[model samples]
Target: MIDCISFFGLGKLGLPLAALFARSELRTLAIDIDRELVARLRAGQVPYPEPGLDDLLAEAEPRITYASEARGAFGTDASIILVPTPSDAGHPEFSSRHIEQACRDLCAALKARTEWRYHLIVISSTVFPGTVATRIAPLLEQLLGRRAGRDFGIAYVPDFVALGDVVRGFQEPQFLLIGSDDEESHAQAAALFRRIVAPGTPIQHLSIRDAELAKVAANVFLCTKISFGNFLAQLADRLGGADLDSIASALALDPRIGGGFLRAGSPYGGTCLPRDVDAFVALARSVDLDAPLASAVRDVNKAQYDLIERHLLAGNPRCVAVLGLSFKPGTSVTIGSPAFELVRRLAQRSVRVAVYDPAADARESAHAAFGDAITCHESITACVAAADAVLVCNSDPAFRGLAAKVAPDRRIIDPWGCVLGTHPGLVRIGRDQALAASLLASRRRKPSLRAVR
Candidate 1:
């Protein structure tokens, strides 16, 4: 029974997992190199925005300890490495330097301990297929001067989580994937997951490399679904009378399809999906196997953005308000966000772009992407009030009432079908021409519906 656990890399995913472990009544130590971040956590401040995190942190505070050094993690019975394994330049493979360095530091801590005690080492970071067995295991064994399976148990147990819904995903994972060098290692990792996750959670134990492949494969499959939905959406838009929402909803009823990630919206973008697809493609290529489906998924996602750009530009709005800058709602991460890219392209075209996101740091993210070229609004109403067109990029709940906020002349480009009320200027991406024509006709009757540009 692992009563105490140490977590490496106290970033977005790491912190939440640590909190959950603490909430589960386990003594949890969270270690990070970032001094300020450690300071913030110790001060009872969350480093990032996550739903239910603050409350969870409060509940788990007594059992959770924050530390800036790796040595602080020495006494814990198990250590899970959750550090960033950033993608290598010009390739899909993730650089394992961060996790490697963490393992080295952890080795030093283990060496310094006078008494030898068995510890479970779990790699929770996403890595390439062969990373665990070839790279991580060898390096850890060399540094610690011990055998992985015998001296210390090691397992690759990547978390299947999305940024916005991480808390829920961690608490109630569909299934836990464990890749271990030995049976004992697998059981140790599974036991730890069982402690934190829901009762009777299904667990799949695989070889180290298989688990690595499964992690990326899962995301790639999801990206393929999203891209497929977008492709269907485009078909619906082009072939009048075809409804994407209805089609997707019907397709989702199939037991095999399972109805998740089938919604048609902006291209799939975030920290994980795009990168994972690219990595999977690269992984396939490394072994002389061509992944045409994965490649197509990537191409389709990029093309979806182009389609959106064309639609927004076609309207020729004097100013466009881009609502929801984050990749998706409920999180503040904006990496590969369609809204972020849309703002950049619109600004380059001198389209007068105004952006707002309820969760994201609009000013900071906008400045980082393009400095002062776009206006960041504090409120959604403020963002769309002056614009002739508003593009709701993400499916944030705050963006649902955009129809009531904007004037009838203001065009609402909703990709996610978030806007409910029927307004003349509301342009749904996947809707047929008849709906668009009706909206246009209503605007023409009003006579004040001239295009701003």
Candidate 2:
């Protein structure tokens, strides 16, 4: 059996994956170019606050070793390189410099370690369509001096873990999607996944390009559902006082329209959706496919964010308290987060913003957004204690409990619809951009807008 070695750069994607495999008692060599990160991991902890991950590393210290230098790290072992391949800010997938650099590093590693005839390199990073076929496969072929299927193996397995729920996803994933060029590579990739993920989680094997396409398309479809929800919410509002909660229930009876991921939001951001959709658009452009519908999914999300920004501006609240920052409900990774975007846009006004999240602080994903301008509160009650209005950015369960206790005089804007069963002073956006504005327009009145399970 070949020994295990891994290369990583993006601490968010790379750390957990490298740590997990190392924890399994495999002689895993984790490599990064950064000297500080190398030193930090060597000291038995990662910089990010992924749940249960610090503890996992403490347990796996003997198995996992961190390295700044790749001399001994690139031994004759199975190398799995996980890099952060992010798309550009454009609507369509537009950047690959990170992936290109990662490939170049891997190519150098391949050349240096030619002694290992049976090398298995897996791409766990997210990439645009045709990445493995156009970029990864050819690089491997050129470096190894052999055909892929006949001599070596490779797989494109996108990591589906979010920041806060990463450990949960890693320990108990929905399923594994491994894209391979040939049978040997597919089998090898499946075996690696079987070792890591839970038994019976099921691994789907397809062409490398197919797997890459599936990930981007899945994001597009999910974004489309979000936009469709927003569209329906608008129509529901114009129908002379209608409840979308009920209308959605009525529509969900149809088999085609499932009642999942169809909720409204400020907008989809933080690490995916926008960029993935952009990548898909770029891919479609390359392939000469007219993806108007897919393209609009991103446009709709952008408009949704703009609507939220306008609503906040319309209120003209002096002190706005933001509840969450991460893209999703669970994670603390706030890069390109809609809430962060909201905060930035809102800062252009004269509003002073105080932020709090149950799982977020200066450590995880809040520092960059609220360095010195915002106050980080210890609890949700403290976060909203002195605010004129509260904007619920993420759907943390803690916010729901705290929302009930919010003073009757203050207004609460729940963009994520965390308030399932409603209370006084709480407003559910529920995908209606207009309704979200209406909540900000009216003052605190009688407790009439209440939703129940």
Candidate 3:
């Protein structure tokens, strides 16, 4: 909106941030290389599920425009690049292909247009240390034929918004971290962000690498806390057998350990944590060092998902009605989700998958990801209609409805312990295990998991 080309890649963060700018009457233009993605957005569609995002896109669409190429989006004059740097394989290995491709598109854009003399190039993506000066700066300046700070306004403002709560996060951000070349660029970027975030959300200024490292460290800490809970849960399972609630309560008493992420269902899923941990360790490995904690975090998460498979296929059933498919409740995004992984592994077996999610369109999701090979149903009833045993795949509230619906004679092998009421066929595995037992008291508090017989 400040008379600049806002280049955004990886629709995850780029879309929401662009929406924030667009809603403020900024005339924002968002670019994605995926032609299908462009078509969907133009048609008022969001492929992924995030709370409040569909509405946000609808509200921001009026002021927003889109293009597949940088000539239309960047305009060679002024641009703000928001390219996502994601991790892969629980290693800190980053794929800058998406980032570099966006930059190349921008470079062409700068060469093509001869309109404006001033070009302020700000990066709002996650980059590793020394990425800006060593990697991004040279490529950008060579493309623009200008000095870093003089001819253009260069800054690094890493995004901290989480996946599920992106739109709402724009309003009440925890903090804004910016790494700038000069005071003017910082001020301009700050003023722009101020328009989007709440009045009091502090914009902390630091060196470019520091800003990058800060974002990484923040995600690393969050993953660490969660992994710590998971590790403790394993220990609790060992001690309490079927009474993990006590261990959970005792841990909550420790103020240093918050209650969040402690309530374990499945391991953390979706796009962020796994790759973030990988990137953290990969960065360390590049320096001939190893990040043991981060490495363990990845191992634990992967192990949890793997364990679900071990427990499920142990007493294999033919028609397994998976309770939930999305990562967690309140959203339906199965990308890299543990439940989705479970479904995939389950599919490889002779088992037939009947998946239901509260928010996701079963046909659209299944077709886009795996096609008609996987079955889709409206309610748990349809999914469980012919099931030999049920598996609690996701933690959607709809699982509770399933608990109430499964007939008394039905046997459900819920790994997530969704169906509590005693029925003839409700054989929940992972429940007898020490880890599953500890969460028993914790599950009792939730109405959905109350388990009626």
Candidate 4:
């Protein structure tokens, strides 16, 4: 039983994961290179917003310790690295410098330990295939002067959790993937997961390279599904009377295509999906192969964004209020967010923009990124009231009643089709006809609202 664990990198995913370990009764040493972050975690203050993380950290406060150096990890039985693997500028591959630096620091700490016990090192960071066996493992051996599997263990145990729903996602993972070169290393990593995951969770063991590929492949497959759904929507729009929602619903009935990412909406924008697709393409290219389907999927996603932009810019509303800023609901992350990109475009066109999200961190991110170019609002009502048009970006349930808030003449551009009602101004991206023409025609009628569940 691994009772003590150390986690490197205390960013969005890392802090929650470390807190989860501590909540599971493990004495966890969480380290980060940022002194301010370390200080905040030390004082039991979460540096960012993650649903349920504050309470989880509160529960784990007694069992968890925060540190700015690797020395604290020496006492832990296993060290897990969850550092960022940022995509390299002007390349499809990730820059592994951050992961490499973490490994180097950990190696120095391990070498200086006066007393040594066999320690397990697991990496949960996203990486390109062959990175572990070719780069990380060799670097560890060269720096520490110790052979893996004999003196210590190395395993790739990436977590498949998304932001906002990370707590539930972690506690109820569909399956666990463990990649290691040796049986002992695999066993150690598997034991840790078994302890945390619920009973009957499927666990697969694979070689280092396969696991790396599997992670990227899984994300790319999801992106494919999303793009396919968008493709259906586009086809439905081109062919009149073809309902995308109904078509998707029937397609989802097939066991092979059980409705996961089948809902048609804004382009699949986020920190993971786009990056993983690019990585897959980059990997295929590196091996003298072409992944046309993957490339097409990316192109389709970009097209969806263009479609939404066209709808939002219809009639050239003097001021537009974007209801959601985060890529998805329940997260403050604005990276690769369609709404954020829309704001940028609107700013460039000198279209006054107002933005609001449920999370303050997301609002702050927008304020910081756009400065005075955009206006951030504290409430949905205020944001909608300030603009002449409203663009519903994400499918946040809170935006369902937005039609009631908008004035009859003003338009509501909902790409996700999440907003319900027969308001004349409501423009459903995949469901409605050419937005500008329809909006022009609808203004010649009376608007009324009545609802029943």
Query: Which candidate wins on TM-score?
Result: 1
Error of 2 at 125 (Å): 1.0
Instruction: Show model 4 residue runs off by greater than 4 Å.
Output: 433-453
The per-residue C-alpha lDDT of model 2 at residue 13 equals 65
- Give candidate 1 misplaced runs (Cα > 4 Å): 433-453
Model 2 agreement with the true structure over 352-416: per-residue lDDT tens digits: 88888666443245656457667778688888888878888877777767556677777787655
lDDT of 1: 0.86
Clash-forming residue pairs, model 4: none
List lDDT for all candidates, in order: 0.86, 0.70, 0.69, 0.85
lDDT of 3 by residue, 1-453 (tens): 265456667377788888887887777778887888888888888877777888888888888887776667545334667766766555356656666677778777666665646566778777776788887888877877777777677788887776678888778888888888688778777877788899889889997888877888888888776666555545443434343345556778999875666654567776666666677787888899988988888887777666566656655667767766666666656666676677778787867877766665533565477565567777778878887667776555556555577766656655445555566655444345534544566667867866731
TM-score of each candidate structure, all chains considered together: 0.93, 0.85, 0.82, 0.93
* RMSD in order of candidates: 5.5, 5.4, 6.1, 5.6
Candidate 3 backbone overlaps, count: 22
How well is each residue in 1-453 modelled by candidate 4, as lDDT tens digits? 578988899888888888888888899989999999898777767787778888988998888989998887767789999999999436779777888999888888888788777889999999888899888989988988889888889999887999888877887898999999998899999988776688899999999899999999999999999999888777655443245677778988999898889989888888888889999999999999999999999899988877777877887888999988999998889999989888988999899999999988889999999999888999999998968789998999999998788888888988777888867788787677465345435544525311210
Query: Each model's number of backbone clashes?
Result: 0, 5, 22, 0
Q: Model 1, residue 252: displacement in angstroms? A: 1.4
